[model samples]
Target: MNRKTLALSAVIGLLAPVLAGCGGSDGGSDGGEAIVVGTTDQYVATEDGPAPLDPAFAYDTGSWNVLRQTIQTLMHVPRGGGAPVPEAASKCGFTDRENESYRCTLREGLKFSGGDPVTVEDVKYSIQRVLDIKDPSGISGLLSNIDTMETNGDYEIVFHLKAPDATFPYKLSTPPAGIVSQKLYEPNKLRDGFEVNGSGPYSFKAEVKGDTVVKAIFTKNPDYKGDLKLRNSKVELRPFKDADDMGKALDSGDIDVMTRAMTPEQVHSMVDNPKEGVQLTEMPGLEIRYLGFDTEAPTAKEKAVRQAMAYTIDRGKLITKVYGGMAEPLYSLIPSSVATHTNSFFNKYGDANPAKAAKLLEEAGITTPVKLTLNYTTDHYGEATAKEFETIREQLNGSRLFDVSIKGAEWSVFRPKQTKREYAVYGMGWFPDFPDPDTYIGPFLDKDNFLNTPYNNPTLRNQLIPQSRREADRSAASKTFAKIQDIIAEDVPVLPLWQGKQYVAARDDITGVEWAVNSSAELLLWELRKGTGTGS
Candidate 1:
């Protein structure tokens, strides 16, 4: 992937005001069998925007939400949650035990939403273009393993890998690997504008663009040959300023569903009050929030100092005081539900021991009252982050071994700066790109990891990760994942804080709320249906 340029921050700064101007009437059909869903996120030149629907350029949740429904991939996480399954292909798997070579054959009679034939050349070109454009912040991390691509016939394609990558197929199932219409997109650059062309369950229609996008329209693709059958004829996506606005819209019957941006307080209120016409679906916990540090920073370079900070922080207190117990403490980088997850950090640090932390600092010859700055985003990470970091500061200061100061940035600015490693220590959250332990461990260990924190553990980066990727037997591979967690705990580059439950609030009458969130934590709009009160 190409290195990201800092210009993205300026581009994102313009988005909020541009989107704030998008206020207008719902402009959607509410009386009939229409379903409207919204998020507070703005459409922008960055990954968050709802426009520029081409898969190569879109990476953030907003773009991924639209792409997951409108574009077809080789495989996908089924609605209601399960393993990745074939979507456009009849089948795909490795033909070699070394995991270096793979092959797939397209389902017969496959065609794009625009009626173009889904040929092997189209598949080959779509994959190659992602590498060619190489948007620094794009999902190219998912495709970095490719060595070469070859095709035998119109329907057959083979992938020759640079290394044995067991999670390669999982990568194919994500938005970054979305197959495109070769006839439409330029092979060397991202397609311009919001006119999307794909072969998924839905097809793109006119976007309601203002200074910001007030709404986006989509209709079922009559030509789509994938296994998924749409329950709704059209999908209308709107954006609200926050969850409170979205809750008001849902209560006022202005929209049928609300997917994200609800604070824990708002969610709890809904659970207790039981809004007459609304139903809240509390999804299984799959998200992780954490603190990451720059290993190369002078303050953090000392291993004992980092470990001291880890042992001193009280995770239980953070969950209760900052999150109000809306989240559970996370002991490992991988969530506990996954088989590969291991509580290495918890095993090493236990609950919290201030005395042990102080001793560690003393042994390392570090002076008392070390200074560190904690950074977080005010808006994107939710309003609770201020409290979360303040709680962290209190926990550290209580030990009397360190002095902590807190700083806040809007997500647009924060992301770029963090990626550039401007902050010595910072808070971040992760939503899985695909459902696998490799998704959690591989990126951070990669030499060009997304964290951009200065770290290069040759054993984890060059040996353990690639070794784990070579195992076709996932059960056997999990042992290597356990080893990885132990190494991460020893290093303490990132301290896992807590895991949060996914929440979706919809009208009580809306069917399929249970199926809306897949195992990967992606929102599947196709699974949603208007209530039986609205005629089918």
Candidate 2:
């Protein structure tokens, strides 16, 4: 029975655009076949674009994985659950100094999507080239700890380190740090993300410029020896301009899966809409929406003031009411899912207490009209955000403890602005760099942290961060983050808000959905199939 032919009479198009199941027009032809997965996301493959297909680039660049599917990193961290498995490299390891001194032994005879043999030179060139681009885009920041690399043999390569970065292996598994072929890479014109070449399960297929992309087709790499999460070779990705359109196709039987986070309002409506053919799976994410205070010198110098801010607002209600149960109130910078998590802040601040906040503020010489402004990203996170900020405003304004002003900026402006320590008080959300406590605590605590907004803590940078990474054992690093989390709670440079969950809508026919602690958690397209309308 063709999956597409499975009762067309039952397929009734909605009044508005809704999503349909997989295998509609393009995935498989067998077992009630064909899966057409489309995202409402718009992508740019031009030089000025983020270059969607580069593996060592564009993971959480957000809204650009249309081409990311066609590239392969050394490993695939499906839903970032546990340890990563091999993808491009057969087996890779650090000879010493974390991933600082690392080597990957190539599989016997792997070839690129263009059919060039996977070799040690490609691995070395890929890592080295990203450094040439010098885009911290995140990987450059993580790999900055590396000093140098050179091929040891035809099948092996080794890297040198600037520091003892234990997360090096894990970092290599990151998509932003993926390997690329050197043979096809043009050093003179490396900025072109559109002309992607890689050794992943899927190839570029057909990128209809900007509006829509049709992945020509995909198949298993004949020489693949690396352990990866999925093996479906015939992966195809279609591009739709709007999620509503995508949803219409989803409801109308075109695409197979959808997982961008929606406001709690949307989620509730989804829960209530009673669309008979579709299924919704909501998973708690690790991203926490909170306010970041630059407490380095004059801006956020007083501990009592920070604590008063924390005690004045209700986080639980904020998550449930502002987020509509789409998020869980978080007490720690590190969520419970990560290692070395403790409820130091929760233990301290039980609930919202305006009376206590007033006294604390009074003690700090801060008055009711302590004018603090908040900043937010207009388009980056999700729909609940604006309402979330409004809720915070009402909470503080009602308390007579604050005269709050809010500012909103797009991610383009916000990213560099926050990095320059431009905001006095701002709103930001962070998806973990990795699933560990270090990822939760380290980057924020580092004096030169990516957030760029400094927290006035020299010991955190000079002592905690440097000491933790220098520790040879990774577990030792976890313990360091525990202390770091406590310091964060004590100082309150950034308040702990809510841990966002990953949500997705897939047709009953689609299978294989998972998420990990890392940032790029989504269906790999390389590993999905249309079931007999049965859940995967």
Candidate 3:
């Protein structure tokens, strides 16, 4: 997800003001108490007043965690993961052999939380607004393939693509395609504040403190019509300032489950010394961290300099030192979990050879101790980010070929500068929007890529990406993806650092923890319940 800049446009003054409500009791569904989930993910409002909870504007995981519960997409990734399934739509598929034209029929009797009927016009409006506003922080890039959208008899919506895109159905499963009420939301403007009108399994009332969302109380949406079955009737989401605070809340019983932003130390503690009445669930994850370069910057502008740095940094040591072995060394933008993954970086640079690094600098006729500035966000990723960058600095400096300086800022400050290409080099993390290998590779390399960097490879962007997207069978596109990875390694626009594993710490009574999060890292809050475990 792109955690870039929030739009600063003035509020349109059309939508209703924020709504307030009391927390629910646990005695509503299956004899369970209200499930309280703790997270360190923060959602802040723009200075002009729109909050990230709006599906058209939210591009961060924090906002999506809440939106997925309230906003119903036409298609959704299944509980475990494979292919996209119909959610608001009765069925969906590409209509043409070229994989260009796509169509979906809305489910019968679908209604929003307020009992408004979900019509094809609402679906068309919801998607059109995202493209029209085109918030720099939003996921509009995922929908760039759409040439036009058409409605048929108020029940079906058809999409015409500029080119073949087999992944369009997967993109529709994301929050950017979430259907909103046309009567409630503006046609061309964002709905300010945290109030959401959606057709998902649950409806929420948010409590905001200034820009931050302090708490959100969610109760079952009685008018909801969807595929998911609500395991619990009531749920509460509490956002903390940090992992320590979130962990403390979990320990004190203020929250029954803790998921995102847990520190490596906290994870290890829970694994080694089990807390009473708590259990840990570990799952394979597609989340990845990497270092990106501003290709037009003075020092990093040199290709050899970028390659040398890549050769000198050891992923094994960095993961061991900072992540405490909680992460695995990543060799390509696509994580190993994907079928198309390749160890292109390892093949090109090998295992952190200082000699190779020095030789590249000498061959380029560059003097020793190349001065460079590396930027990172202090708050977005976690506290461990500082140590991760520090370890990187030491590794590069120890090679005697470069002198690196690190700068830190909060996400609000850091993302704007990074997008403006102010930093020569910066750190970034990715939680794929979908489970496809294309999600891992496309967002960084597409012409309208999320990174907003000057780095561009025409062969990769124009030829390979489109070539792969044309193939309906993803496995048939593996060779093309491997070629794309080879080009990425050769260009060195970004350096893959590590891939993380997903972990959730929760009380033993919390059932369905294993299925609580989908393959794309979206919180499936409806899957969680207060009962004996129904998952492995």
- Among these predictions, the greatest TM-score belongs to 3
- Per-candidate alpha-carbon RMSD to the true structure: 9.4, 7.5, 8.6
lDDT by residue (437-466, candidate 2, tens digit) is: 566665666533556554657878677776
lDDT leaderboard ranking? 3, 1, 2
lDDT of 1 by residue, 239-337 (tens): 776777887888798988777767878777876666666777765556788888898888778888889988998899889987774688999898776
The per-residue C-alpha lDDT of model 3 at residue 353 equals 98
Winning candidate number (lDDT) = 3
Candidate 2 C-alpha RMSD relative to the actual structure:
7.5
Write down the worst ten-residue block by lDDT for model 2. Answer: 8-17
The per-candidate count of clashes, in order, stands at: 2, 27, 3
Task: Give candidate 3 misplaced runs (Cα > 4 Å).
Answer: 1-32, 48-50, 533-536
Q: Per-residue lDDT for 282-362 in model 3, tens only?
A: 755668999999899998889999999889999999999999757999999988767688899999998799999899889
lDDT of 3: 0.82
Ranking by TM-score: 3, 1, 2
Kindly report which residue pairs in candidate 1 clash with one another: 43-49, 44-49
